[model samples]
Target: MYELTVVVTKVLGTCSSEVPMKPGDYLTVRNGALRIPEGGHICLYALQSLMPVLTTKERRIGEKHSDDWVWRVHHVQCPDPEGRVIFHIVRSGEKAEMPPYTPSEPCPQPQTDPSLADLRVIVEEVRGKCTSGMQPGDGFLLKSGRLYIPAGRHFCLYALQATLPLLPAKQRAPLDGDWLARDNHIICPDPAGNVVLRIERV
Candidate 1:
């Protein structure tokens, strides 16, 4: 798989994030995993907006051309009407290594650090139509890094993407005045959908 790097290219309006995001902030995707700088944060809403195209961008397609939509479309904007953070996706041309495990080998155990807390992500409200049919009470749990959606119910992938990046940060105890400590809510990137989710440490 191709390694992809997403950079914050511009901010058109005030960043409403607890920690204001600006240009030069970036994150990397390697082997389907995300890496952000230590002590740095990326807007959850911005990540949700990028979810639809990130997988496609991580492929080794043909050379760049004007006709190819994937080649031409490099920038994505967060769904926040007030704080439109623009992201530029760059195909780094680096190949990501796959996990070194065979089919016969069992899957690795989930990380269970004493400092990391379990979490619960709940649908707080739905102001508009939720395409996935998620309701205010729909929710899921993240324990030992494994996601557990209640049987017979589901969580929206788009909505979940908005909260994934922040779960690890929230699992740990926050530093003095850390923005992640202050913010526990994430809004789905769909402007019309307006799905709000609350993250709680358990």
Candidate 2:
């Protein structure tokens, strides 16, 4: 697995990952191990080193298919001290946003904002189609970039938003207590956490 530090906005536009250091908008990249889940997740690992940036149709030199340079977003680990892909970073893709860590039980409640009223879902198309707000073709955006959909959940959301569509009339049940919002200030839970996010809301 290749370990490249890319900006979230570049890869995922502005959806914002809950994990930090992603440089994207959605879902923060938890520093660990992961993998390329499926065809829907084909793009996750596609952006690797020396990988050609050609589309599926562009590589057809002839009906014989001479060259095929593809890039799938892989669920690689969060890079180790030697910067290696030695774990599962979860490339759930369009299958489901949060795989591997399936919420065994229902998402716990007050359930924060009912039906995710305060939150906005950025797009997570299976074939790399950007969704709603934050930026044109960027993905989606909540208020001031607080909470965002993780890449792992992209599959679920795509199925839900595209096929099912989580509209006002048919909204799904939301998890309680744990809400995904833009935390301008990351208050240090421990006095000793090797972090550097001192300022609130950059």
Best TM-score goes to which candidate?
Answer: 1
Instruction: Give Cα-based local distance difference scores for all models.
Output: 0.71, 0.25
Q: In candidate 1, which residue ranges exceed 4 Å CA deviation?
A: 62-67, 93-202
User: Lowest lDDT 10-mer window, candidate 2?
Assistant: 193-202
Cα lDDT for residue 114, candidate 2: 51
Candidate 1 residue pairs in clash (backbone atoms < 3 Å): none
Best by lDDT: 1
Candidate 1 structure quality by residue, lDDT tens digits, 111-202: 43667787899999999998667789888776544455654556665677778888878888999989888898999877888999999987
TM-score of 2: 0.19
